[model samples]
Target: MDTCCAKALVTGKVQGVGFRRAAQEQALKAGITGHAINLADGRVEVLMCGERTAVKRLAEWLRTGPGAARVTHVEFEVIEAHAPDDFHTG
Candidate 1:
């Protein structure tokens, strides 16, 4: 399968709501490799690289996030693929 990368900034009520952890779980399940982290401005940033379909699926999931998260917006960019060894949370 062809690989791809997605970079997204998830906004609104995302922090302190286990958003990153949930994203990591979702990514792993989808066979994505990258990281999810809390930004200083109270948003969650995610980088996912893997199969094109898997990455796209993960990006869609980011739109809603975990049940605890009130995802108001998701800004995403498609980039050149660079696969990581594993998914991570930071």
Candidate 2:
């Protein structure tokens, strides 16, 4: 399983919607490392690195967000892998 890294910015109805927790769960399930944080501007930022397939699956899940989330946009970019120590919510 090849590895890949990505930095994603999710916007629209993201904050205060359990988005961070969902991200943490997904990352953990996928054996990925990174953190999800809510920015002051009401957007969510996620930095994740893991097996390519796992990360891609996680990214797809992020597109829809959690059951309570109203995701409107997800902007993501793939980058060089910098495997982090763990997955967390910030």
Candidate 3:
């Protein structure tokens, strides 16, 4: 049960479509903690921290967000950060 962190930038019809909320739901389900925020460049930035498998799953899910989202691309990268106690959107 290795723990890790991953940051992903999701583009295309992501914002204003409940992407962050959906991500939070998925993160909770996976026992992950972090945040999903809307970037000024019209992308959704998702930060996931938890088990390696859960992080990977959340990252993969970002590729095809909620039904309202039209994800065109996702840029993922592992990083170092202090994880929060629960998932959030900002």
TM-score each candidate.
Answer: 0.88, 0.87, 0.87
Evaluate model 3: give its lDDT. Answer: 0.93
Show where candidate 1 strays beyond 4 Å. 82-90
Error of 3 at 39 (Å): 0.8
Identify the leading candidate in terms of TM-score.
1
Between candidates 1 and 3, the one scoring higher on TM-score is: 1
**Cα RMSD for candidates in order:** 8.3, 8.3, 8.4
Model 3: CA > 4 A from native = 81-90
The window of 10 residues in a row where model 2 has the poorest summed lDDT is 79-88
Candidate 2 Cα errors over 4 Å, as ranges: 82-90
Which tens-of-lDDT digit does each residue in 1-90 have in candidate 3?
689998899999999999999999999999999999999999999989999998988888999999999999999888975547897899
Itemize residue pairs with steric clashes in candidate 3.
none
Collision count for each candidate, in order? 0, 0, 0
Give the per-residue lDDT digits (tens) of candidate 2, residues 1-90: 689999899998899889999999999988999999999999999998989999999899989999999889999999886557897898
lDDT values, one for every candidate:
0.92, 0.91, 0.93
Question: Deviation in angstroms for 25 in model 2?
Answer: 0.5
Residue 44 deviation, candidate 1, in Å? 0.6
